[model samples]
Structure formats: C-alpha cells, structure tokens
Target: MRVFLLTALTMIAFAANSVLNRMALAGGGIDAASFGSIRLIAGAVMLGVLCALLRGGLTLGGRGRVAGVLALLVYIYGFSAAYTVLDAGLGALILFGVVQITMFAGSLVAREAVPPRRWIGAALAFAGLVWLLWPGAGPRISVVHGLLMAAAGVGWGVYSLAGRRSTDALRGTAANFILAAPLGVLIGLALPTGAAGTVIGAQGVALAILSGAVTSGLGYALWYNVLPRLASSVAAVAQLTVPVIAMAGGMIFLGESLSLQFVAASVLVLGGVAISVLPLQGLISRSSGS
Candidate 1:
C-alpha cells in the first residue's frame, strides 16, 4: 500500500511537470533555459536542506555519478527547450516514448534478460504513441521538438535506471540536483532560450519553485525510494501513464482541448502498459498449478 501510494504520487508529480512547464512557457512568464535553471537550483536547495536535516550530510560521490548528473542536465534543459515549441501533452508522449525505447535498449545493452511480456507491453505502448503522434492523426507534433523531447526521454531513462542502484534515495537524489544545478546555469547561458531579453515574472518564479522543490525534488526522492522495488520493465511501462495525466491536467488547468483520437490512443497505450506490468503470468501459472 505504501509503495503503491508513493508511486501514484510520483506519477502525478511527473505529469505536473509538463503542465507547469507549459503554463510558464506558454504564458511567456519564463524562458525555457531560465526555467530549467531555476528548477534545478531550487530543487538543489530544497533537497540539500532536506538531506542535511535527514541524513546529516550529502554524499556527492558515487559510481556513475558523472553520468547521472549529465543525464539530469540533459533532461532538464532538453525538456525545457522542447516545450518552447511543443504542446505540453504531445511533448510528454514523445518524451516517454523515447524513454521506453532508451531504457529497453539499455536493458539489452547491459545483457539483462527481458521477459516476453515486457516486450509486448512496450510494443503496445509504442504503437499507441505512434498512433497518437502520427502525422495528421491527432495533434500536429513538431519533429524538431519531438527529437528534443526524445533526448530528454533518454536522459530520464538513464537517470531512472541509475536510481535502481542507489543505496540512499534522498542523498543520491540530492547529489544529482546539487551537482546539476551549476551546470544547468552554465548551459542555460549558452542555450538560445537562456540569452538576455527573456522575461521572468514572479508568478513564473513561484511556479518554478513548486516544480523544483515539491514536484521534482521531493518527487524524485520518492521515485528513487520506490525504484529498487520494481522491475526495470515494470517501471518503464508504469511511466506510460504520465502523458495521459499530463494531458488531463492541461485540459483542466491550461484550457487545452481534448480530442477523441487522443482518448482512444490513451486507452490503447494504458491497456498495453497494464498488460505489461500486471502479474498475469503469475496468476496464470498459479491457476494452472492449482
């Protein structure tokens, strides 16, 4: 029950990121680079303080630490930059689609034995994504933005896989944010979105804090805590829900329109994810044995 609740909350937080990013970006309150920078810095501050309070200090060094930090930066800046031109929900779908592919590919590269059910689920989810994102099928997706989101997806996928090996979720998460914050700032200045003349409003700053501190910082901590308990394939499929949740949030909060095609595709994608993650094989085996 605790794990379920935590995972659910984390999923909501993940979805909220897309909506919040769209809110700030579409409203012209914050530039993508600045938003990503503030998000990392704010998350770093929040997580650093929490780690200090809870764990006494931060462990800034670990195996694969550099890769983790780089992955974090890629996700932050790529996600932010992609949103400048991509619709919130579409960007999310693209992001997660690539995340699924990346993680699955990583599993293969690492010679992890992937089960057949996982392949089916991943395929279904990918097919649903393709259906939704198909040219002239649903929303008009931007190819450049799609590729950018795909990069973010790869980053997130690697980050998630890395989390499974973490000994301390809070400490590790804090370290990633702390290390990435400075790099995010530097990358922001060079990125087109981060240059001078970008507007930043109080409302945007507040939103960024919420995104960084509550949703991202704490959210990632929760996820890292839960990751070790789940199979890699299960975790990958579980995140397929984010695009649907993000789209719903966009409609409710951002006043985006919903289409029937989206609903159908969502159902297909979710069904695939469910099939992949559920313990159907176990149930079938038990029933047969009984």
Candidate 2:
C-alpha cells in the first residue's frame, strides 16, 4: 500500500509537470528556454537544500553520475522545446511512447529478464497511444516537435536506467540537478529564439518555480526511490499512465476537449499497465503454496 501510494504520487507529479510546462509555454507565461532554465535551477536549489538537511549533503560522483546528468539535460531541453509547438497531451504521448521503446530495448540489450506478459502489456499500451495520437485522432502533430519529444523520451529512459544504480536516491538526484543547473543555463542560451519565446513574465516565472521546485525536483527523487523496488519493464509500463493523466489535466486545466476515442484509448492504456505491473501471479502462487 505504501509503495503503491508513492508510485501513484510519482505518476501524478510526472503528469503535473507536463500540465505545468504547457501552461507556462502555451499560455505565453514564459519562453521555452527560460522555463527550462528556471526549472533546472529551481530543481537544483530545492534538491540541494533537501540533501543538505536530510541526506547529510550531496554526492557529486558516482558510477552513473555522468550519464544521469547528461540524460537529464537532454530531457529537460528537449521536453521544453517540444512543448513550444506540441500540445501538452500530444507531447506527452510522443515522449512516453519513445520512452517505452527505449526502456524496453535497453532491457533487451542489458539481457534483463522480461516476462512475455510484460511485453504484451507494453505493446497494448503503445498501440493505445498510437490510436490516440493517430493522424486526426486529436490535435495535429508537428513532425519536428514530435521528433523533439521522441528525443526527450530517449533521454528520460536513459536517465531512469542510470538512476536505478543509485546508492542513495536523494543524493544522486540532488547531484544531477545541481550539476545540470549551470549547464542548463548554457543550453537555454544556445536555444534558437524561433524555437521559444524571449519574453519573461511573472506568472511564467512562478509557474517555472513551481514546476522545478515541486513537481520535478521532489517528484523525481520520489520516483528514484520507487524505481529500485520495481522491475524495469514494470517501471516503464507504469509510466503509460502519465499521458492519460496529462490528457485529463489538459481537458480540465487547458480547456482541451475530451473525446470517446480518448476514453477508449485510456482504457487500453490502464488495462495494459495493470496487466504489466500487478502481482496477481505472485499472490496466487503464494496462496497455492501455503
């Protein structure tokens, strides 16, 4: 039950990040570069403080430190820029679809044992996502923006894999955010003006701070804490819920429309994720053995 709650909160946090990002970018609250920069810096500050007070300080060096930081940077930038053109839900769909693929492929490359059921579940979820995002399914998708989201997905997948090796989730997450904050500044500066707005507003800054300090920073740390407890496939499939949640958020918060297709696709996604992660077999086996 505790693990379930933690995982659920993590998913909500992840979905909220999308809503918040879109709210800032789409609402003209801030530019993509500025939002990303503030998010990274806010995340760094929040996590840094937490680490100092709670974890006894942060560790800047570890086995997967470089990969984690690099992956995080890519994800932060790609995600921000993609939202410049992509709707919140659309961008999330693209991001998680690629994430599903990247993580599944990574599992195979690493020779991780993935059950057949997990594969079927992942496939089902991906199919639902495809149907939801199919041409004319919802909103029109931009090829360039879709590609950018895909890259973000890959970055996220790699970051997840890297974080799995962490000895301390808080320390590792704090270090990643801290190290990436300055680099994020450089990346923000390097972004093409056309890709994002140049204007900075108070509402935009507030949104960025909320996104960075709360959803992203705390949420990521919580996820890292939960990751080691879940199988790789289970973890990946579980994230299928983020897009659905984000879509709902878009409808309620962004005034996007809801459709029957969304209802159908959401069912498929939820069912798939449940099948992938539930421990029915374990419980049944234990009962039988007893």
Candidate 3:
C-alpha cells in the first residue's frame, strides 16, 4: 500500500512538472532552454544541499556515476527542447507513450515475464493515446516537438533503468544532477539567444525552481527508492498514470478543455495500466493456497 501510494504521488509530481513548464513557457516568462538550464541547476543545488545535510557528504565514482549523468543530461535537454513547439497535453502524451514503450521493451530485454493481461492493457493504453493525439482530434502537434518528447521519453526510460541499480537513490540522483547542471547551462548558452533574453523572467525562474527541486529532483529520488521493490513490467505499467494525471492538471490548472475522445482515451489508458500492473494471479494463488 505504501509503495502504491508513493508511486501515485510520484505520478502526480510528474504531472505537475508538465503543468508548471507549460505555465512558465506559455506565459512568456521563460524560454525552453533557459527553463531547462535553470531547472537543472536549481534541482542540483537543492538536492546537493539535502544530501550534505543528511549524509554529511556526497560523492560518485566509476561507471554508474557516468551513466547517471549522461542520462540526466539527455532527459533535461530533450524535455526542454520539446516544449518549444508542443502543446502541454500532447507533449505529455508523446513523452509517456515513448516511455511506456521503452520500459516495456526493457522488460523484454531483461527477460521479465510479461503476462497476457499486461500486454492487453498496454495495447489499450496505446489505443487511448492514439485516439487522443490523432491529428484533428485535440491539438495540432508538431513533428519536431513530438520527436523531441520521444527522445525525452527514451532518456527517462534509460534513467529509470539506471537508477534501479543504485544503492543510494538520493546520493546517486544528486550526483547525476550536479554533474549534469553545468552541461545544461552550456547548452542553454549555445541555443539561439533571442528566446533566452525575451522569454525568461522572475516568474519563470520560480516555476523552474519548483519543478526542479520539488517535483523532478525529489520525485525522481523517491521513484528510484521504490524501483528495486518493483518488477520492470510493474514499473512500465505504473507510468501509465503520468499522462492521464498531466492531462487532468492541464485541464484544471491550465484551463485546457477535455473532449469526449479525451475522456474515453483516459479510461482506456488507465484501465489498461490497472490491468497490466495488478497481481491478479497472486490473489488467486493466495486464495487457492489458503
């Protein structure tokens, strides 16, 4: 129950990230790259401070550290770049779909047993996404934006897989963010300078900080903490909530409208994920074993 709650909270946090980013960017308070850079730096500092206070120090060595940093960079940059052209809800859908597919593929590569019901569930969720995002349905999606979000999804999938092997979730994430922050800044500087000067403001900075420190950094740490106890298939299925939750956040906070197609899609996606993740056989076995 605790794990489930944590997972739910994590998804909400992830959803909040999308809403906050959209709010910041759409409000003309920040450019996408600047937002990404600021977010990474803030999250790194916040997590670093927390680690110092809790652990008395922080350090990362060897291959795991290297991989973590690389994955973090990919996720941060790709995520920021995507928002430049993608609508909030559409971006979330694309990102989550790619993530689901990536993680599901990872499970296969790792030889995790995927049950039939879970496959069906994944299909249903995908069907929902297709319905929601099909051109002329909800929002006009840019191909470039879609591709960038897809890259972000793949990056996050790799990050999640990498984090699963870490012994200390907070320490590892802190290390990754600390290492990735400088690169993020460098990339921000290299991007076309027009958007940087025009878009960013105090409000954007605040939003970026909130996204980095609270939702992303802490949320990711919590997710890593829980990953070891979950199977790959379970993790893949669990991520299904991210898009739906983001959609709701978009509607509530951003005044995004929900159509009948969106509602039906949400049902299909959530239902599919529930079917995929629940351990029905365990319940059956326990009943029969008893």
* Candidate 2: segments with Cα more than 4 A from true spot: 1-9, 129-139, 195-197, 222-241, 268-270, 283-290
* lDDT (10s digit) by residue, model 2, range 142-225: 767767887898999899799879888888889999999999999898888574448689999999999999998889778878
Give me the displacement of residue 92 in model 2, in angstroms: 3.0
Greater-lDDT candidate between 1 and 3: 1
Whole-model Cα lDDT of every candidate shown, in order: 0.82, 0.82, 0.78
Highest-scoring model, TM-score: 1
Over 197-241, each residue of candidate 1 has an lDDT whose tens digit, in order, gives: 667799788888889998998887778779788776567556867
Tens digit of lDDT per residue, candidate 3, span 51-86?
Answer: 898889787663467767877778787887777666
Q: For residue 63, what is the lDDT in candidate 3?
A: 46
Count clashing residue pairs per candidate. 0, 0, 0
Model 3 earns a TM-score of 0.82
Residue 255 of model 1 has an lDDT of: 84
Give the distance in Å from residue 196's predicted Cα in candidate 3 to where it truly belongs. 7.6
* Model 2 residue 259 lDDT score: 62
